[model samples]
Target: MNTADFIKARAAALGFDVCRFASASEPWSAGERLAHFVEAGRHGDMGWMETTLERRAHPTSMWAEAKTAVVLGLNYGPGHDPLPEMGDASAGYISVYARGDDYHEVIKGRLKTLAGQIAARTGEDVKVFVDTAPLMEKPLAQRAGVGWQGKHTNLLSRTRGNWLFLGVILTAAELEPDAPESEHCGACTACLDVCPTQAFPAPFQLDARRCLSYLTIEFAGPWPVEFRKATGSRIYGCDDCLAICPWNKFAVASHESRVQAREGLVSPRLADLAALDDAAFRALFSKSPVKRIGRDRFVRNVLYAIGNSGDADLIEAARALLDDPAPVVRGGAVWALSRLMDDEAFAALRSERAGGEADASVRVEWAADQA
Candidate 1:
């Protein structure tokens, strides 16, 4: 077999579901779409996306010696449906991707191993990226024939569904490039219709400012008022659109153990998560990706979900968190109390807001509850 075939076989052996190569060059069309998305302020507080335009659009610009860009996909689809537990109000929902080990470390290690194997065989310089670099991975994956970019703007494969994590390897060695996959969305709007926040303004476009994933994980302030009600109990990331996709029927459980859901993360109790102190939270999520958001932000997200739970039993948990040191957490607690408790409880919390020195945003949240 030639070099391309050899690489493909090696990738499969290394547990990659699919592998494809693309010429290292500017992704002009994808860049144009990204530029439009950024210019519209659709990326929200993710300002890094705007600053790294050149590096994000062109692989050759990132590394001068790069000649072939190999894109690989690893399937992490769950065996059971993830939507049922989401309907349970007392249960806090975490995005499936984050329930286990961090994919960045897992995928990057495998990519490096693959790169080392290539170096030994061909003596070529290489770099591997697993979402850490500014590379437009979804576009590269599509160009490499792994999948088409779905209407929701995530990479989607017919065989693996939307449950694949992407990794890229850039090398100086020339490899035969694969043809890009054709778009399969057709006239179907299942993803758009199912979005709780209406994050997608149009087909193949996303406004991350309104995206629950961005609001819960990326945005680092008080949750935006407009999207809060739509956020439901999603504490980390939103998967409504992805879950509703018709293409998911073909998906199977991933063989990678690192991608499996943890015991507590699959559908955690809201009250239990709301009570987690910093150390306890750290101990529970030490190696998980959700820990990156930190205890304060994670607690704030839990408070929002508790507010939506409508379970009067959880109100005591929300009340106990009113004195949290982080104003963000305190503000979320106040909001939860306002939503889930009686007027007497809200009035009591409102009285304490005067003595508490909180951020201007949290103060506004307090006043809004009183009003």
Candidate 2:
């Protein structure tokens, strides 16, 4: 068997759903598109994208000797559309990928094991990478025939749909590259149309500043007034575009148990999540991706959800956060209370509390305009 065939076999044994090869040295336009995205300031507050622009342009830009890219994908599909979860305004809607254990933790060890086997068999230097690295896995995945980048700017596969978690193994060995996947998204606007924030600028482009996923995850501080209400009950990442894809019809639930939804994460109550202290937050998301945002930001997101919930029972939960040490959390509380409380009652509470707020931004949240 050829080297590519051997690697695919080993990757399957290691539990990867799809394995394909691509020329790491080949020139691709993904870099130019990313540069444009950053240049247009569409990357939002993610300064790391600008900082690593040079190294992230191509696989060879980071490792000059990387001749081949062994792209592997793991299916993490939820078996059904998670969009329906948003209907439960009292519960927080976490992105499906983050409902389980962190994908990095789940996929990294398997990637390393596969890389080691390839190294042993081919006598080649290999480096394994998950999404944490500078390597742009999606473009490489497309070049390797694993999937195509859909209009939503996410990798989509005919068989796996929008639910694949990707990892890459860059090696010095020269393997024949697989046929690249082409654009299968024809006249489909479901992903573009479904965004609550209207994050898409045009087809195949995203303005991250307006994306709820970015606002809930990568962004810190109290979100813009406009997005706070639009956030609905999404306390973490938003999955509207991913869940709305037509290709998902062929996708099945993930076979990997570790990637399945956890006991309380699927559609957790907003009140329960809003009550999480720092210690409790750490414990609840011990091995999950949600822990990275830290307790304050996560609670801030929960507060936004609470504001949009229209559930008056959660008023006490928001009221309790008024004195939170984190300015952002306190700010979020103010917004939540404004929505849940009557005008006169909210005015009385604001008059009592707004003067004492030390943070400038939190004080703004207490202003009449916010209510």
Candidate 3:
């Protein structure tokens, strides 16, 4: 077998679902698209995208010697559609990709192992990248024919559907490139229509400011009032676009045990989640991607879900957090109380608690709810 074939076989043996090669040094329009996205301020609070623009523009921009990109994909498809889980208004809906172990930790070591083997065989310098680095894995994966970027702006595989996690190995050795996949979305607007916040400005563009995943995971402050009600019970991430894809019909359940959803994370009770202290949060999400958001932000998300729950049974849970240490959490609790309590009760509670609140943002939440 040739070098590219050998690399694909090794990746398969390492548990990757698909492996393909592309010219990393090739000029592509992806960088320009990214630049447009950032310049338009669609990247929201992810300031890092603007900070690393030069390096992230292309693979060769990061490493001048990056000749071939060996793109690897691992399928993490939930055996069934997870969209229906949102019907239980009292439970939180975590995005499917985050329901399992962190993909970075799961895929990084394997990419390193494959990189080491490739270097030994070709005597070429190599670097491995999971989603962490400035490298754009989706464009590389598409150029390598691993998948096409669907209208959701996520890589979608004909075989693996919308459920693949991507990793890339950039090598100095030039390998035969695979045929790039063409867009197959074909008049389908399912993904765009499914977004609660209508985050997508157009078919393939996203405004992260309105994205629940961005708000729940990356943004560190209280969400705008407009998005608070739209968030519904999604505490961590949103998968409505991915789960609604027609391509997913061809996808199979993932064989890898580590990427499957943990029982506790799937459709977790909003009230129970709101009651977790930092210690319990760390223990529950140990080794899980949810832990990266930290207990404060995670619980803040939970309180939003509690507010949207309309269960009133969870009122005590939200009330209990009114004095929590994190200002974000306190703000979220205020929002929850506003949603779940009646006019007289909310006004009384606001009168009682709003005066002593020191945080400006939390104060704003109270003031906003009063209006």
Candidate 4:
């Protein structure tokens, strides 16, 4: 086999589900969409999107000598439907991918290994990037024939379906690029219709500010009152759109042991999660992706779900957090308590704690709940 074929074979041997190549200079039309997403302020608090647009718009702008891009996808399909967990209000629904090890580390290590093997064989310059960089991975993955960016704006394949962790390798060596796949999403809007928060404003366009994943994971402070009910039990990233994709019929559960769901992570009890102290949180999610959000924010998310749980049993869990030092956590607790108790009861509690509620943001949360 030639160098490109050899690299693909090595990638396969390394257990990557899909591997393909694309010219680094491929006319990435999605750049225009990204520009628009940022310009429209749809990215919300994600200021990084604005800062990186220039480089993300063009691969050549990122690495002038990049002659080829090797895109690889790691399948993280769930063992069962992720939707049911959303209805199980007593439990928190973590995005399937984050139930195990952090993909950034797992996938990046594999990417480096693949790049090293290629470097040894071809002796050409190479650089690898996971999601953190200002890289437009989905469009590049489509350009490489690994998958098409489904209406969910995530890479999905006929074989791999909607579950994929995309990583890219940029190389100076010129390689034969794969033919781009045409969109097969024909007459389907299941992904768009499934959004609980109506994140997708239009076909193939997502407003990140309205995305449950962004709200739960990225947007800090008190959970937005308007979206709290819609966020449901999703404490981390969401999978509503991806799980609803009809294309998922062809997908199989992920086999990567490192990426497989870790014990006690799937649909964990909201009460237990709400009780996690910082040390317990760290221990529970030591190498897991959930730890990235930190103890306060993760608890903040759990409190939102607790508020909506209506279990009433978790009311004490939410009540205890109302005095927590973290303003965001206190704010989230206020929202949870408001949901669990009536306005009269919440007002009484607010009156008692009014003096200690020193944080302005938490005060805002209190005022909103009272309103």
lDDT (Cα, tens digit) per residue for candidate 4, span 1-371? 88988988989888898999999975767778889889999999999889888988978888888889999988988856778777688999989989989989888988999999877887788889998787888888888998898888888899988899999999988888999888999989999998989999888889999999998888876655778888888989999899888888899999899999888998899989988899999999999988988999999889888988889889998988877878888888888888888778888988887767677888888778332
lDDT of 3 by residue, 292-353 (tens): 99999999999888888889999999999999999999999998999999989999998887
lDDT of 2 by residue, 40-71 (tens): 99999999999999999999999999999999
lDDT of each: 0.86, 0.93, 0.92, 0.87
Candidate 4 wrong stretches, greater than 4 Å? none
lDDT of 4: 0.87
Tell how far residue 21 is off in model 2, in angstroms. Answer: 0.5
CA error at residue 49 for candidate 3, angstroms? 0.4
Q: What TM-scores do the predictions have?
A: 0.97, 0.99, 0.98, 0.97
Clashing pairs in 2: none
Ten residues in sequence with the least summed lDDT for candidate 1? 349-358
- lDDT per residue, candidate 1, 237-260, as tens digits? 988888888899889999999989
Model 3 clash pairs are none
List the candidates ranked by lDDT, beginning with the highest: 2, 3, 4, 1
lDDT of 3 at 3: 82
